[model samples]
Target chain A: MKSLEQYTRFIEEKIAGINLEEEPRKLYDPLRYFLSLGGKRMRPILTLISGELFQISNEESLSAALTIELFHNFSLIHDDIMDEAPVRRGKPTVHIKWNSSVAILSGDVLFVEGYQQLAKYTDKRLPILLKRFNETAIEVCQGQQLDMDFESRDDVTEEAYIEMIRLKTSVLLGCALEFGAILGNQSEETRNHLYHFGVSLGIAFQIQDDILDLYGDPELFGKQVGGDILSNKKTLLFLKAKAISEASKDARFGDLLQMAPTDSKIASAKKLFEEIDAKNASLETMNGYYSEAINSLDQLESKGLELGSLRELANFLITRKL
Target chain B: MKSLEQYTRFIEEKIAGINLEEEPRKLYDPLRYFLSLGGKRMRPILTLISGELFQISNEESLSAALTIELFHNFSLIHDDIMDEAPVRRGKPTVHIKWNSSVAILSGDVLFVEGYQQLAKYTDKRLPILLKRFNETAIEVCQGQQLDMDFESRDDVTEEAYIEMIRLKTSVLLGCALEFGAILGNQSEETRNHLYHFGVSLGIAFQIQDDILDLYGDPELFGKQVGGDILSNKKTLLFLKAKAISEASKDARFGDLLQMAPTDSKIASAKKLFEEIDAKNASLETMNGYYSEAINSLDQLESKGLELGSLRELANFLITRKL
Candidate 1:
């Protein structure tokens, strides 16, 4: 099995090969800068691993892998503007370094580039790939809208939150896996199962992200802990906390939650969170999703001859600390 | 030839027929709303005329026509935010009605829809159409950047301004015509000539826009008269005036020109502009382009058939006061 560092290096090498078109230099320079200031590159690497699992490691799969990653970064650029996020991956966001307008246009050009890259596939898979990518793109936009909408509402259900996360975050990962399967010439059933594997893994990953936002070690985590709490973000942990702890019994907890979870409120919210054990509850829910993801992987094994690479990917994704 | 109002109604009726994908309601609602606040829909009608001239009114041509219009509106939504313009076509701008973020996302979704709409063509035409569309899209972005960049610089040449407008406003029209020719399966030479025809016409149309901004009847214009002057926008008039009226010979004109064309400076700028007959010079320059546009139309007669509908469309475009 390839180590995470090995996967990271592989993605870096792959990303370096992408050739951005000229003339929209302003629009694409930010893409270059942003990708250079790398994150995990997990999505593309997972795509590569998924392809490898199907015993397919060719230029086409590598290009598909890069296409998804480009698409992912394009979303990040636009999402950062929507979120008003100042930093990403321990660096200034594209919008912050430039202005929001440039970021918006740059992100737009990147989105176009993403599709342009995907269109490089041979005619047989191109239509299917494009149709799926377009559907996923639209869903991601809808998920983002729901997430923004949730910020204003107090009565968001855990189920609704999970569904929103599924659309916003999970579907793209599913797309990455499905795209890999297409490149591998896998059967439709295998592709669908792999998609489920990706979706479940994504949900687990996002839930873990929510947990780490409150409970992670600052030394280990790249971002400020409890950032979501401070922002009053509707995450799985918060939803579970509100759900499991009866409102009447947690009236004080609600009152404290109204304040930004800063130095003073952080302690109180932590105490209340502990009282509800929302962190552990979120972890348990995450584990359930992770278990389901593993099960999907197991199901795919029935059809697959080679399963080692995909299993390693699932394990690495499910077990990541940050 | 169709009257302006006849063409306008045709555009409105045709645009109204566009449908969004079901579900993911929030993402596409703004597109519907933006389209509902109707403009003249001139671009698509121009495309339709291009197709109709060749007697090519198939599903692919109609979809291509619709796609161009959608792409135009998509750009307008983003451009409105960039311009910080509050109103469009006598209604609130999308960014003003919703937020910048929503406007951004909706515009993005519409962009994708434009491509999806284009994909309805046969595979033979699809690649060429998409490639042209992509080039035009990138050119549009570059043009916008040049427009924005013009705001900060005092040294913008008239040639540079013309090129910027060509990139910003003309390329898509050219692509629209060229796309129709491709759909009609016209020869490459014919298609290229038609493209140039549309581009020359686009430049004339834009220059006429500048002329109307200053001199058209206010009620007919549906916008602030002398707006370019008020903003000290580097329009054709300003560029021409700056080029001809030497700073030494016309000290007041030079002084007013150096200042930002804000409301406070607008009266003085107008006085200085009148001193140099800048408006008249701009109109004369506009006429030159308009004449050149007509000449290009005359040149298109040799392409294949007479292209009577395309000629009519060009005449209508150049003759419009608003």
Candidate 2:
């Protein structure tokens, strides 16, 4: 019955204790630096919360929680390299601070270390856990592939963008919960309910992220406002905005989006998105997914599992999201 | 009871049956291309051979073999990007054919698929197999890191270079064999002996490679001879000559290796290595490891296992090395 802050502290201490600060400093130093630069640490906390929902103590789930956190950092380090990102969590990225070679090798080590953490669990469930992890890992790669592919093409639809987010980002959330449920000895069907709950919430959260990129509270947000617009990523809002522009024959909309990178471009793009109701449409879609997430949780409640803190966390993901 | 050629054919067919030729063509096409540009396929074949030494069928060991091959390709894809290598197996590398982003994502997929193949084995050995694979995977990264580190350091000793290659190139061979032995139900001690056998042979084979880069027949070699020289790699021959010139106080030898990249630079480097007896020194060192490899095989023989063709494979590794 620990508070969310307690779970966050446990995961952070576990991460800080991981001694990757060894020789071949070129290989491990960047990983140490990247892991030290923390974010919300939401995925590992999800693993802890999922375990608590199953009445498994967070102590029992620490190893798997570490697995999720390590894997998350692995994906981000490699993704930042592929995305050519300069900053992460208000700091230089692994590739930016060291080099891509260091980033690739360190990411590879982090990935292997993730499995090492999982292998620390000697249960018969180990093979099944590894299988699920392998599947989710491949899907994440495929999602990144599709995201890069979308960069050059303009015909990306809203459905495609949602699917991309599910693969790229959401499924890992699903898998993170699923790992805890699996470790907790929940049956496949019951564990899958927890998984779907994560998936729906993950999708909604991503949409909220797209909206926040334009209209979020700057003081609360870690990254630059309107950063996604600057990157030209085909997020859900961008897809919706493109459809609305086409419907209205707004000739100047395309020109506004393609303007030279500047403060004015972001302001103009945000103005057009609000005017065309793309922002509202994205929010509505986000709510729909959020509702679906709650429905999956209700399925769990029907089976007589208490989900008090878990539901609050989901609410916090949407209602009080920074 | 199959011949080495049949083992070779079995591995080729197993690799060919892998269908990564599906969607996200940009992500998969480069993988398909890199795999299709075949090398000696030596590591996977060793898995089959090791399995046979323990009277285990190749079919039982095929999954582990593919794991090794897929992982090998994964390392190469990422390493080639780090090395900025344009060519692989006489074809354009994945990073060259595609871009670094595609290369990074696709390599990540290949790494995960390696675990997928390993997971196909549903036995108690699965966890132990995964544990070994993860350890070997991390060491490979560390090895690559050390190799890159050596590129910048001028005072790298021979022992450090040997340890670096052992980590970078040799341990995977040892791991490939150990995986087969594990699947074959060999005792941990016996499997470890087999692992050492592969380790020694791998080290010797690498030193042989350094020698062949300067002295081997051109038609027999797949890569350009003296390619390492042109790249200014600090190979064993270079280290030996550096030591020799320091002892003899030959001032001209330092300038010979430092000359600009040209055909004649490679020729001068080769001639200087010969003059200093560095090539012979490397071969003697190669023989010591070759002997160490044979002694390990003899240890297996003392346990009453037949060592007929396996011994031949070891001898072939030394006698007929390209």
List the candidate 1 regions with Cα displacement exceeding 4 Å. A1-7, A13-29, A53-58, A185-187, A247-252, A255-260, A263-277, B1-11, B21-26, B53-55, B255-300
Candidate 2: stretches off by over 4 Å = A230-232, A248-252, A258-271, B260-271
Query: Which residue pairs come into collision in candidate 2?
Result: none
lDDT of 1 by residue, A139-193 (tens): 7887888888888898899999999999999998998888888877778888898
Residue pairs with backbone atoms closer than 3 Å in model 1 (clashes): A213-A226
lDDT for model 1:
0.79
Worst 10 residues of 2 chain B by lDDT: B313-322
lDDT of 1 by residue, B1-322 (tens): 5666776687787677777865555567778888888777767776666776677763447778777888888889989988898988878888898899898888888887887777676466666676778778878888987898789888999888889999999988888888878887777877787788778778878877886776667788777777887667888877877876774476665577567756557667656666778777777777777677667677677554677677667776777664
